[model samples]
Target: MALTPPAWRHTLTEVPRGAAGVLRLAGKWRAMATGPRGRGEPVMVLPGLFNSDRSNVALRRHLTRMGYRVEGWGLGRNLGQRAIGQDGERLFARIDAMAERYGAPISLVGISLGGLMARIAAHRMPGHVAQVVTISSPFAGPPDATRVWRAYQALSGARIDDPEVRALVGEAGRPLSVPTTAIWSASDGLVGGAICRGEDCAAVEVRSSHVWVQFNPDVLRAVAVALAT
Candidate 1:
């Protein structure tokens, strides 16, 4: 079972704390110092809700330097359900196209809501997706566990408590056919880390703020290692 959701205090203080974390990116740069090259395989990076591919730019750059062919989701800004409506067939088609382009399975690294989407894609198309890595994504609990649920509902026009939404979230939490890794943070200011885990995937814990998790150097290194394997 997933752990209890974090209290409102943590969620409320997220932005300033996360900004501080973002400012510390320079330190992470110094720490990571060098990049370890990968097998030059195809990797796709998906951004979180309300964010576009731009959010994964830093992570993508790091992966590219590591000799991996990383690309963004390309379906425009992630306005949650609004991007693909409810069915998500369009997103699936995009994943299929990326797989066909390389003629090989693709590894996915997604942040926040993107991670859940990646998990769903992997579950649906194991042949196309070789591995999955999620950073600060809530896969094990209700959507309401996230402090940003209101924003999601406002932007996506989907109610979190809806039975269909709950069912879908539950399905994404199940084991996936591909190798999976979930990178979570106890200090996450937005969604609680407890809900970011999956039973089938190995879980790696990090110290990062929610907004900065994608850009944090440690998280980047973890993602690189997952991609390499």
Candidate 2:
């Protein structure tokens, strides 16, 4: 049986206003100024829920300039729950294909729920996955941080206590067989930073909004470091 989380867990809310957004951009510049160089295998960028591949275009271009093979999730518009089925299967297949084409394992860089999905895919296909880097993902637990996410969970029939989701989350929190890095922020207006914790995961705290994690420079630098490792 899956463990039931405390009711207060669902009350963690998004940061009021968009302060996190401003801080995110600032952190990006800071990362550019001090980040280390990148040298590693290809990287797969997974956008957050309700976001599209276009969302990480800037980050991808930047990483590409830094000498990394950066690719997107190629699926169409991110329509949240709907993207989890056929689209997800196709995405996983693409990861497999990319691994073969590169002749090397691929690193997964997922944002928000996409991070959760990436972890699941990595676990399912460890051979193709080199490293896992998540940005503000709630891997430690369920979607109980905000009313919107709770509603999404209900509407999508994603029971936090469901055996599958629970099992996935539990495994995600355990030591990843491959290197793993989790970038989190106390300023995140969506998921709480607490869920970002893991014993085997290298955790980096950046100042950014939950929505702007893909664009945050510090997070990207941390991702680059993790991939280069």
Candidate 3:
């Protein structure tokens, strides 16, 4: 099936929902621990485009409470290739470091562009990555399928059809040896959810606009379930 950007209605609601998500934060982050507990496994939480590891504080805290050792991407802000490097060597190094430190594979949980990058790590170094969870990431779709395509192009100074860019995108979409889950929502406003998951990957649906998908309570619960089982 073909992929396209989300409709204007969903896009329009993103801001308000983002605000609401912040308020909703007051409710119950503890619910995340109800599902299951971790055994101090290293888990990396990757932020979306233009966002820093700071963006996923709620999720990270919840995961930590669930017994997993969660850490942010450590890289400042997510500027796509600019942040991860031309061939993603920096991201690979981060994964390698975590794996070596833990003496075990680390799970990758990323939102939007971060999710795409997470899949690339799993594809390129499956042994180091135990599993992957992509939130609202359109890795299985074309760049234009998301509202951020032009912004991404501007940030990276590269066109979507560039040969190297295409190769990099190809790496992101390759099948992985580890458990891979794609979490998306039909209510998403920035990117079409249809493109978020490939047929080969497990899919979980939640209700959220693109801006707050990673922070939404239901999304947090979904992430917990994905990581737990």
TM-score of every model?
Answer: 0.92, 0.80, 0.95
Each candidate: what lDDT? 0.83, 0.71, 0.85
Badly placed stretches (over 4 Å) of model 3 are 84-87
Which is superior by TM-score, 1 or 2? 1
How many clashing residue pairs are found in candidate 3? 0
Residue 58 lDDT in model 1?
82
Considering summed lDDT, which 10 consecutive residues are worst modelled in model 1? 79-88
Order of the predicted models by TM-score, top scorer first: 3, 1, 2
lDDT of 1 by residue, 1-229 (tens): 5455577677677777777666777667656646566877999998998888888888898888888888999888787754444658888888899889999999989899899889888888889999999999998788877777888888777888877667668777988988999999888877888899877889999888887678777788889888777
Which parts of model 2 are misplaced by more than 4 Å? Answer: 1-34, 79-88, 146-148, 154-163
Query: Alpha-carbon error at 27 in model 2, in Å?
Result: 10
lDDT of 2 at 89: 72
* Top lDDT hit: 3
Give the worst 10-residue stretch by lDDT in candidate 2. Answer: 2-11
Cα displacement (angstroms), candidate 3, residue 120, comes to: 0.5
Please state the error at residue 76 of candidate 2 in Å. 2.3
